[model samples]
Target: MSFSKIFGGKKKEQAPSTGEAIQRLRQTEEMLNKKQDFLEKKITEELKTARNKGTKDKRAALNALKRKKRLEKQLQQIDGTLSTIEFQREALENANTNSEVLKTMGYAAKALKNAHQHLDVDDVHDLMDDISESMDVSNEISEAISTQPAFDTVDEDELLAELEELEQEELDEKLLDVGPSVSDRLPDVPSEAPAHREKAKKVDDDDDMAELAAWAS
Candidate 1:
């Protein structure tokens, strides 16, 4: 007979969970409601008895009315009990819902923690720095390839000067080509058409005068 065995010998009774408690409360409400219905039926029967016996037997009708009144009191008690049970049941149901929600939230928090376990701010920063360095190297390589020795870079001012010189040479050549043709199409400097026309008229007048003098002679 040890003292520990005597004191801790009985196993404790486990309390009902929120869901179980709510179910019990609902069962109690249903039972009270059934009892209330039974009471109402009995009251109706008592009222019918009183109505039937009222005229023929007054004493019997009084007794029936008294029974009806007692039945109504029982029915009112059941109504109050049912209201209490229903309120308790709803409260238990809300508690159960909140408990489940808390459990789900706790599980979600744990999952999120596990997912981010291997990630740190320093690791993220290092990864971003590596990406930026790689990008910089890539840009440098592209610039080097674009500006290779195989490609020649011409000065903009020299190119403009050469273009202007070519335009002037083309203009001078066009002027030279047109100069001889335009000169060849021009008339001679001295004109002889008027002098030749006056000489012919004078010769015709002298011939006409000589004919007239011969006729006179």
Candidate 2:
């Protein structure tokens, strides 16, 4: 019932967005195109009427031609207006596309800047060099530890002399053992020869005793 509730309370209409403006322009263009087609048909009909009238109806033909001219002027004005609207719409669309492209490029630049915030070319190079040096040092240390210790090198002539001395000592011991074995075998042979002579003397005594016994018998 109050004035504020009746009028002042109403919300103000929002401005049309670019999209809405473009839509309206397209609609106007379509309407204008339909009107153009209608005008063209009317012009054709008027032409037919003027031609058929010839001199039989001069005033009616003149009036039809005049109407046709007026419709053509109106059609021309609509075409110009449609062209203006289309130009404005296309301009707005190009501006919008450019704006979006610039915004995306700005975001990409910001992300790239953030990514490079903690990186330094010098530091990266130094780090790689340090890693490579450490690996080389580790390899050298491993090789040093794994390598076998070298034994003392002996002279070839000294080794040959020592081997010959060992051979000569073994040969002398074998010769001394051979001397004891051969003497043992020779003593056994002489004892067997004395036993054989004693047995032969005993056999000769038995034969003499048997011959004396036979003579006494």
Top-TM-score structure, candidate number: 1
Give candidate 2's whole-model lDDT.
0.88
lDDT of 1 by residue, 1-217 (tens): 9877888766778998998888788888888888888888899999999999988999999999999999988888888888888888888888899999999999999999999998998999999999999999999999998784844767899999999999999999998887677768998765787898899999999999999999999
* Candidate 1 global TM-score: 0.65
Candidate 1 Cα outliers beyond 4 Å, as residue runs: 1-11, 116-121, 135-153, 181-217
Worst 10 residues of 2 by lDDT: 182-191
* Predicted candidate 2 versus true structure: per-residue lDDT over 28-94, tens digit per residue: 8899899989999998999889888879999999988998899889889988988898899899788
TM-score per candidate, in order? Answer: 0.65, 0.50
Global local distance difference test of model 1: 0.89
